[model samples]
Target chain A: MKRRTRKAFISLIIAIAAFAILAIELYPIAITVINGFRRDIVILSGQPFKLSQLTLRSYQMVLKNIGFQLGMKNSIIIGLLSTGISVLIGAMASYGIARFRFSWRNGLAYSFLVFRMLPQISLVIALYLMFSYVGIRDTIGGITLAHTSFNVPYVIWLLLPFFTAVDKAYEEAAMVDGCNRYGVFFRIFLPIVAPGLVVAAVFAFLNSWNEFLYALILTGVNAKTAPIAINGLLGGETLTWGQACAAGTLMLVPVFFFTLGMQKFLIRGITAGGVKG
Target chain B: MSSRKPDTDGVSVSLIKGKARHRAPFLFLLPALLVVFAVLIFPIVFSFFVSGFNWPLSEGAGTRKFVGLGNYLALSVDPEFWNSLKLQLGFIFIAIPIELLFGFAAALLLNREFFGARLVRSLLLLPVFFLPILSGMTWRFMLQPRYGPLNALLLKLGAPEITWLGRPVTAYAAIIVQDIWRMWPFMFMLLYAGLTSIPQELNEAAEIDGAGFWLKLRSITIPMLTPTIMTAVLLRIIDALRVFSEVYVMTEGGPGSSTTLFSLYTHRQAFGYQKVGMASAMAIFLLCISIAFALTLVRKNMSLDSLEEKAGGG
Candidate 1:
């Protein structure tokens, strides 16, 4: 009887805790998702949870917004461009650090580490002023350039483990198997560490994709990301939760896919810091 | 394996191979370096130069009036600047230790092999991927005094619905709660990851010696996790120092500047008040704090790995 009572008490506590967690997280998501389908938030203000009060109108309106579409295109283009450049550089840098000895290797690696420490928020204003001065402020190329500064260091750090763990013999075996350096790297080393490269690329893409502070300061209509565009519009009376929710959900799509069924890999990449990649 | 050792007959082969190896890396690094230099590094140096002169990005404001350390001097005397620094320090003081403690508690609970462990761990990661601005806005909606579910629940439970972000202490308290909620996941993630890496053999040995749960945890679990704890704590410290996006999204340094952190102060100085020189000085100070903490972490991480290797070899 005593043991049964103890189990009941524990289970009750667990249930309560679980409910609270759901209230904090899923409740907001639920509210937002429901509103995303509502024609206007005023209808929901009367009855917030009625399924009959829904419409696809907000999503339609949001999709029709040229700013949203353009922001989406720019994000994808910049994210892909930045990721590709950063990954290629990251692979090489990590390879260099892991496989070779140089006098200033530590210095080079340390420089990259500093970039991770210095998130965009720290130098955002500085970058804004400088970029605007140089006449590159509202261009996609300018955003990409700004992204590469942070992305390169991130890629190098992320890819370091896979490069280090990859046995040198793979390249040697390829070399002795009658291939030159480029041939060995492409044919052997690259394939062996493909997952690490993917991890680095994904992180770079995500960072650039969802980055907002710089986008807010640097870009107006010319280079705004979805987050900035969405947040800018979420204001004042008629702060239609429906419209904001629709935009927010749309912004979440790419990130969702990127994180989908890959939390373990993503988690490993971050905490492992490629130490165990 | 044909003469694979670097120290044996492979010395010259290794030297040539090593030198040749770096060729690929340098080539690989070139594009990234060029882009980074143009965008990031140049701006850092350029910003330093601009900080000394009273200039805005826009040309119509003024031709660069050289102020010669006036910004630094002004920043030191700015009451708002000092208040902002105090706020950031307070956040660091209040946020980090709470996060660590709460995170450690959650990690300890989750570390046990429970039925729903994977689900629980994933639940923790949800906030990590959440955009900071989104996090603030979402929490703001929840804590709204009138129609907010939080208040609704409070009223139902017989407690008066307290305005969380309307007043000073409660407003700052809201930030603390939000920050802790968003950040505890990180500490848990790191500590949990670190906890698993600790060999079970140590635990078994401790068990053989009759250590209870508390004793085993107090001795075995903690010491091993210290380095990782430091790493996570340092990351949090650096991050907390630059707390801007969330606060901006939530309050915009509001309630008469009650929530203004250092970065917010810098933003207000440069943009709101047009104190470019003073803003730059504050930026430099923020840079110093970040650098001091980050450098210590990086240095410690390098030494820890080396020490681990030495211990492994011995």
Candidate 2:
């Protein structure tokens, strides 16, 4: 009877703990999602927990908003381009670092991390001036470049382990079978490292898509990202919570799927990849 | 013995040639490096050079003055600079412990077998992954005194509503709560991973020796999990020192400069006030603080580094 009582008490603590943590996380999400669909902001915020009244007016408003659509497109375009370029570059770099003993390898890798640790805003002001001078202002490519610089190091450092995990004997066997280097890589190596590459690509994509700072300073209309556009929904004059929540709801869909794909690789976290600088 | 070693010089040279031929893979790394250099490296070097000038970030470079060490010298006397430093520490002290406590507790709760374990685990990470501005902006709405849900919930529970972000103390408090929501999951995840790796033998032995759950947790789990816990804490402290996106989107360090973390302060100084020289010095100072903590923490937590060394074969 005492053992059973102890089990019940432990069960009760677990339930309460789980419920509390989940409530802390989910309360904001629940309110936003429910209220995002409502016709009136005043009604939702006033009675945020109520499930009786529901509407779809906010989504309709957000969809029709020009700035919202442009911001969404810019985020998607930047995310795709940056992820593609970064994963390719990172794959090659990590493969090189993993498979070979190049002379400048350690030095270059360390510098990449140093770049990662530096503040993002530290470079934003300088990039703004240069981008304007080079006639790249408000362009998706310029913002994409900034985002890529920050994310590629994360990808390379992350994807290196996957490359090294493939046995070197596979390459050696291909060499004996008269397959050239390119042929061996394609026929053997790429297939082996496929999951890691996908995970890396998704992670890079998510980081770029959710990026706010460089996108904030560098772009006005042409390249304004979702986060910036969401911020602008408030305007400086007043806080438009309803419209802002609607916009935030739209921005979150891609990120949700993006993370679902990338969470496995992040299980070890990034710092475990190789030598610490 | 000579016959057993039957490799000709030609075959060995060709083998050397095969190893040399893999330069094609390294060539694939160029496009990335070029983009990084153009955007990031060039800008950093340009910022340093611009720091040497009295030239404005805007139009023509007129009345340019050479000012070496003048920018850094001013950091010594800058009150806003010092307040920003103090405020950054204030954030670290306030955010780190709360997040650690909540994070570890949540990890322990979720680690045990439960009815909704998988669902709970995923839901727990949701706040951590929310876009920074969206999370801050949501809290803004939630803190609205009359219409906000938080206020409504407080009143429903028979408590008076406080103006959350309208004041300095409450504003920092709300920001810290938002930060803990977003950050604790990271620490919890790390600690959970650390928890799973603990050998069951240790816990079993403790139980057999008449140690209760509390005693086992205190003696075995906490002690063994130190390296992971410390690493998570250090990472969080460094991250909080650079806190910007949430603070910028939330309060923008106001109710009169209450939330001006070092990063946001440097940005405001450099761009808002256009003190490029002073901002660079400020950046260097914050950078020193981050690196100093990082070095000290790593020196103390050599076990985590040793684990990485073993894994990476360094």
Candidate 3:
């Protein structure tokens, strides 16, 4: 009976702690969403948690902003293009490393790992100089190229295990049945590893979409992404808290829903990183 | 099964197979290698070359003059560089353990079967998906001394309204809080995965031996989770060292240079002060640190693999 009571007390504490964590995690997001709908910044100042006179004025203003729209377009283009290129090339390389034994295969695999671990800021300066010299500095294509540089290695790392785990017997049987290597990869191997591809693509898209440093350095106006656009709202003469919050919501909502839908895959992808090769 | 087993036919077939085998891998790797070379490898080499020169963004590459080791030498004596390095180290040391503690606790609590476990787990990961700049902006607004919700809560509780981002220490604390809030979920997710991956038999065996929760956690759970913990810590440290956007958005590395992290400092040197050579030197310095950490991680991974093999064998 004493032990049962002690267990109950401990459980209560755990429950409280979990509740606190939830509040801490969700509070700022809640405030952001609420402030986005609020028309009066003064009311936010007075009563942040109060629900009074909410409107879509801030959202209307942010959505109509040309810079915001351009940023959205650029972000989508960069995200999708970079993700596609990264997954395609990375899957090929991962397949090579997984299927073919070569003298430098281990070295190539580790190099990809190292590249994936590299800090973006470390490479941003040189990339800026190089891209400008090549006359692609402020273009969306240039930013996509930069994003793919990191994402490809990431994709390779994530997909290597997936490809390695695939049964070689299937590929061999296909080849023996008169299917060429390319045909086997497309028709059999690719279909088998579709889940890994989806996970890699999702990560690549999110990473590119959320990336700021490369986008900030490489693009000036024409190719600025959404994160940069939202950051721009934080600066300058006026502090448009309402509009900025609205913009933040716009930037966050899609990713949030996407993440919610892909939570299972995301969890697996994350845990897969911890798995020993 | 065939005449191919004879010497002449077997030799020719083996040679063709060998050639094809060698060529196939390279064919598969070509596109990725080309992209890596053009984007990552070439830029690194270019950066190293540029770092050797006193290059300025304002000046064209042609007009720039070489100043070999001048920037590195300057960086060695630069107080701001040292300060930034110190800040980075401090941030890592302080933030990582706290994150681990919070994450471990959360993981422990959530590892149990619960009604809202799935919903809570998904909600916990929300911060990980938040755009850093937006999160920073939200926190920046929320941490305001007068109008911020936090201070408002303090006032309601009859506590003095302390300036959250007004001073150096509090400002730095705010940065740490923002980062921890954004990142603790990652650590939690990884640790939770690690916790869940431990076989139930081990814990049951420990319980059968009259072990309590703490004993089981210490002897069985932690030992099993070491690799995951190490991976999580290394990744977090590398990430913590490169923290830029949060600082850029939150404090802008100041009431002074109090919170000037390495990446933010590099940004200031490169863009704010137009010291490309100096900034490139700093970037290389950071790259060196990352490489060192990567090497350590590789070494740890190897040792852990051996340990696992030994455990499995035994």
Estimate every model's Cα lDDT from 0 to 1.
Answer: 0.72, 0.73, 0.81
Q: What is the DockQ for all candidates, taken in turn?
A: 0.34, 0.42, 0.47
Identify the runs in model 2 with alpha carbons over 4 angstroms from their true place: A1-9, A41-45, A236-239, A261-263, A268-277, B1-28, B60-63, B291-314
For residues B1-314, could you state the per-residue lDDT of candidate 1 as single tens digits? 01112222322355336547446557656766776677667766766776798765455655668998888887778787788788878888998899899788777766654345567677666666667777677667667775565776777778998888788777877887778877887888888888889999999999999999999989999999887888888888878887887888777777777889888888887777775655666776777778787677766676323422443344
True contacts kept of each: 0.19, 0.33, 0.48
What is the DockQ score, from 0 to 1, of model 3?
0.47
For candidate 1, write residues A2-82 as lDDT tens digits.
998998777666655644654564555566566677766443343444567568888888888788888878888888998
- CAPRI verdict (incorrect, acceptable, medium, high) for model 3: acceptable
Which model scores highest in lDDT? 3
Q: Return the lDDT, model 3, position B114.
A: 46
Candidate 1 chain A lowest-lDDT run of ten: A268-277
Predicted candidate 3 versus true structure: per-residue lDDT over A1-277, tens digit per residue: 9998997787667666676778879998888888888875664565777887789999899899899899989999989999999999989888876666555755677677678778888899999988888999989899999999988888887786677667566877777787876787789999999988988998888889889889889999999998888888888768788888898888787788779988777754543333454
**lDDT per residue as tens, model 3, B1-314:** 01111112222243223434646578889999999999888877877887898877785433567899999999999999999898888888888899999899889888875445677777999888888888888899888887788888888889989888889889888888888888899999988988988999999988999999899989998999888999889878877877888788888899789888999999988888788888888888899899788767755664222322443344
Model 3 segments more than 4 A misplaced: A1-13, A268-277, B1-22, B60-63, B302-314
Candidate 2 chain B: worst 10 consecutive residues by lDDT?
B1-10
Clashes of 1: 0
- lDDT tens digits by residue: candidate 2, B204-252: 9888999997998899999998977877887777667777888888888
Q: What is the interface RMSD of candidate 3, in Å?
A: 8.0
Instruction: Give per-residue CA lDDT, model 2, range A124-163, as digits (tens).
Output: 7677778888988799888888888878877877776667
Better structure of 1 and 3 per DockQ: 3
TM-score of 2: 0.89
